[model samples]
Target: MAHPSSSHSRLFRASLLALPLLLGGAAWAQQPPPAASAAAPAADPGRHMLAEIQVIPRPVGTADDRYKHVDAAIAVIQASGLRYEVHGLGTVVEGPPEKIWPLLQAVHEATLQAGAERTLSIIKVSGGAQAGGPRVEDLVRKFRN
Candidate 1:
């Protein structure tokens, strides 16, 4: 298997660093999501967005591996090009809610594709209708080292 180059790693790190600005800037708010120029803002008027999304895949444990299903669900999140950070209880994602919300469904379905009989998703979203909301850095920058 081919390994990811250092440039790809740097690119991904840059994406993470840039995510907060994207999620909390008037520039992003004024424009529509990449794919949905006209329909997205109408569907979700929030100027910026952040979501804590967690997926639980049932048959959550097996004799062979306790976290197999959970791993599959996480794989989907990692593969998504959107910027995200995985935390203890959930993974936080930042982007236009119109795009993030739809992607949540895909994350939820990933475990089922991995052979889980059932799945559940817990999601919490925060944003503003009149202006951009706080970015992750804005909320927890002090906690970082």
Candidate 2:
């Protein structure tokens, strides 16, 4: 029979040998792959785009009360003077991609800054040519008729 201390020492050595595998190897401490060294091409500021933004904050229950969060988001969109329409599920805004992207970011920040503890923003973007693209009205006018 093996001595108790000898068994314990064997178990300890075994555990030490398993530690690296359990912890995902020593590569965990190694630096990640270097980022792309080349500078990315600059985006064209005049590229036309359409975006739908929906901001949902927590504590959703009552309809009247929940609309305040939606209202807060709309206020930001209104303030930006961008062409937009407030639909049943979300607001659709159209402008240059450069403008619409930043405006979406601002809308999100404004909703949280206004006092929402948590916020979820859903954004859908459609990019098109710099000079022409479908607007919100064009997409929904058929349904309205």
Candidate 3:
């Protein structure tokens, strides 16, 4: 029987390592090409209440500084005749879509006025028939204290 040399042993080990990579690359070869613009946003015309929020000047600095800014912003928003709750560093204010939109705009303007340098993200929540978009109807279902 002939024995393999050191060079042949090295080559054999290298080929073993390369086999899995080659097989994985071949698996991707059969997939179809992607579309030009990818998937489009489907229009949900289900009368959903969508909240348009502007989260300007989010907490970017230290935790204490961020808390200060958040608290101040929350105060201003709270004074605007709305019910709000601050969960951790985020604020959750519930109301009609129309009311929430204006509140978000106010929050953005106030945050800028309070000397916020960081950019804020705007978010929206659309609760369908499940929650009815934070209407005044929730008050009627309140639990007896």
lDDT of 3 by residue, 25-130 (tens): 6555566767776664544443335343545465543454755544556777788666665545466666554566667777766665666666575666656654
Clashing pairs in 1: none
In model 3, which runs have C-alpha deviations exceeding 4 angstroms?
1-66, 127-131, 134-145
Candidate with better lDDT, 2 vs 3: 2
Lowest summed lDDT window (length 10), candidate 3: 43-52
Best-first order by TM-score: 2, 1, 3
Off by over 4 Å in 1: 1-46, 61-64
Top of the candidates by lDDT: 2
Q: Which candidate, 1 or 2, would have the higher lDDT against the true structure? A: 2
TM-score of 3: 0.44
